[model samples]
Target chain A: MSYGPTPWVQRHWDLRAAANFAAGGAGSGLIVVAALSGARDAPAAVALLAGLALVAVGLFAVWLEIGRPLRALNVFFNPRTSWMSREAIAAVVLGVFVLRAAWLHATDSPGAVATGAAAALAALVFVGCQGMILRAAKGIPAWRSSATPWLIVATSLAEGAGLWWIAAAAHAQGTRTGLALFGALLCVRLFAWLAWRRSIARNARASAAMAPAGTALSVLGTALPLVLAGVAAISTSPAVVLGLAGTAGALAFGTGIAFKIALVVRGAFNQGFAIPHMPVRGKRA
Target chain B: MTRWAMVADLRRCVGCQTCTAACKHANATPPGVQWRRVLDIEIGNFPDVKRAFVPVGCQHCEDPPCMTVCPTKATKKRADGIVTIDYDLCIGCAYCAVACPYQARYKTERATFAYGKAAAHEAKRHDPDRLAVATKCTFCVDRIDAGLAAGQQPGVDPEATPACVNACIAQALTFGDLDDPSSNVSKLLEMNEHFRMHEELRTGPGFYYLWDRSEETGGVPALKRLVEEAMDLA
Candidate 1:
């Protein structure tokens, strides 16, 4: 039987999944940045823990999208040939490393480089897997295009850096690096935005496909944080005080979540049969 | 010990969704989740528009980022540069999904498994709870493993090429090991002005594209020159 047109409810679920994943991923990265940016104190720790909670929820949300949670192990049996398999393995490896780092921090471990390097590598791997996933898509000009993966990386770094800056007020070294990172993230964000705009103009359908989600994400997730970050940078009334900077940071973080969710939701609904798959005929009973 | 690669001749690609369809079938992927996809990119204005059918999949980079960010070590890169995922360990956090520069990873949701003919009738036969995890192209890992066990070359397959590679009526997709310099894929890369999806990132992606001369000769030549210059900086 030919599948009828996709229903709105199904489309809504698809979009929601996308949004949750995007937001969750972004949230996880932000938490890492927060830790790195000097959220070692109790308040910062609380915030980091909160972010982790979000990540945990997001992970479970993603699992709900799979076909056989029990057989998910099948993905790892052939790492020699499958990127999906490799991604799965990497996800586990990074998880252990990051959690260890968090634990080390909690237990007052002496190895800073070990923890830092592991977290950094995990961040990079996370970004790479995202890119691989996008690169693997066969069609959908918006997604299959090369810029998709790069954008994911840039956005993560940008968002991470932004979060780091917000969390930097709690630490000395984090303050310096956080400032530098903020500047760098701004530049990358600008470049990615420009590239996305250019690509969209060149390919209308591609642009349209991504625009709904992109606009929502940018407005709520990226722009809000950026505005807050800027305010925080300009204001001099004690960075952590209950004023503009603190408020902006909170808004940025919250918006980032909203933005991620919106993007995912849009992506889910936008994807349709640009090219139809061969309809599988029913098995002879 | 197992390096994987793919070569695509832009001239031969007809933009058919065969590879996409085949991939969905082989992987039994849910809707909105494709391990491999073909891109129909049209450049220039309507009158001067030139379209190219580029089949994209995981580059399985030498330096895979997915391996780093996985809080659970779900994704890993083999010694031979092939990137794989351990779904069992994946908490479905989708961190790799955002980190990937290619957007190659996908998160499965409830209605994803209900596609196609069999999926339509037997949709209820499948468990509903397994819809929450990340997924992407495996380069047909199961087939590749079986092939290697039987002493087959890295890219050659008797059962079926990758879903996308096998589905190509134009025979546009080529799969093999780039480590073997004598491999057809290597030869193709060596002879042609081939390009990976995003060469500037220095990820060392395994997938390569050979653009048609006609398309490349026009404004693409200028773009290529710019890309070369940018690569030098990168």
Candidate 2:
């Protein structure tokens, strides 16, 4: 709540803003994971729809937060200079491919794999756009760090992998490749988070506020998920493997959302004012 | 090549809050919304502390972050370096607010008066276009533009200058074309040791702070003076 010359957590964007990053990032990641994992049939269609649904939910939150919803279409006006505009464009690209792939997969048609691959690429581009949106906000030291984009992308990918594992398990399918990807992304996410945290270490208030979330992400989101996925990979029993994989997926996905929420809401502190030189009273020199 | 800029003489500012009042009065800003404000900063240990009042608002940067981050092209910098917002185009997402390093942008959704109810003057001056959109200090652009049409110099004419600059009792604030060598702001900058806040960010801020007048006294630069004394000892 501190204001004036001191750094303060921004109030303009609250929980709703966090929801955009969290849900959008994860949803885009899931689309990529589902496609890469070779999911087909109804499961592939369901995954496509599920991913799009999450993205839609995130967009809804953003629409609700805006002061003038009627003018929301104007967001596409500045693609040349604004990452937000690029994100909107990327969303359309993702939607087109996902819908095409979903239709092909649901009907067991040819070109399902190719369309899924195209959708995955679109999803990756969308997630990158989301990361750059936060990175372009130079006023927030935590978000403007060079490592921020990487952290955001890595966490979203991890979240996607986690969701893919659960979907695969629900369909009584194998979770080997998705589990491996999830574990690797968890490790990558941890590294990215550490780098991002280090970049903003000079901002004590923001670092302190985000410390708990960072710790939870490392332990629960990364370490615990890694352990569970490892156990699931080695287990011979189908039920046990499914249970472990699903639990790991839930933990990683849930922690990613919580971490993003903390980042957008709690860690987005404004760069406060500073007077480099002080003036002496009644003195010319 | 008119680049409007403001120079704040830190030594003369007395933290009177007069400029803030003038700005609010001129703009009819909602309660708790201040387009221009001064910060009272106390530096050093208690026994040797020194206090300074700093006037801060939008720097109206040459490369404004708010302008770059505005999704709808709502925030823009004019040819004269004045940053403005197109309220009709704004979606009120507040993305520009978070993008402004100076914390100068504000977004208000509803109209509220200073005393709970809108008075006659407040109601008369209230701007519906500003509600639910991003707004900031325009540096009194309307006055400057009007004054220009009237063939009056901005810094020299009270009617052409910003309300805050006109209301500064101590003459702490000066506004003029930075591109003009003989302008008030340009002369003040040349005669004083001035610094722009967060200059390292390379925003090329239009606002400058004059902290010392050593050059006016024909004294050696601080760096040169130190080098001379060291050479003398050697």
Best by lDDT: 2
Structure candidate 2, residue pairs in collision? none
Best by DockQ: 2
**Stretches of candidate 1 above 4 Å error?**
A1-285, B111-130, B212-234
Q: Any runs in candidate 2 off by more than 4 Å, and if so which? A: A282-285, B216-234
Cα lDDT of model 2 by residue, A50-157, tens digit: 998888889999999999999999999999999999988888889999999999999999999999999889888888988888888978888888888899999999
Model 2 TM-score on a 0 to 1 scale: 0.95
- lDDT string, candidate 2, B1-234, tens digits: 999999999989999999999999998899878899999988789797888999999999999999998999999999999999999999999999988889998999999888889999999999999998999999999999999999999999999999999999999999999999999898788768799988887788999998887554323565576688899999
Q: Candidate 1 versus the native: TM-score? A: 0.50
Q: Give a tens-digit lDDT track for model 1, residues B133-205.
A: 5667788878877777787765556463566777779887888878788887876666555676555556677
Model 2 chain A TM-score equals 0.96
Provide the overall lDDT of each model, using Cα atoms, as 2-decimal numbers: 0.57, 0.90
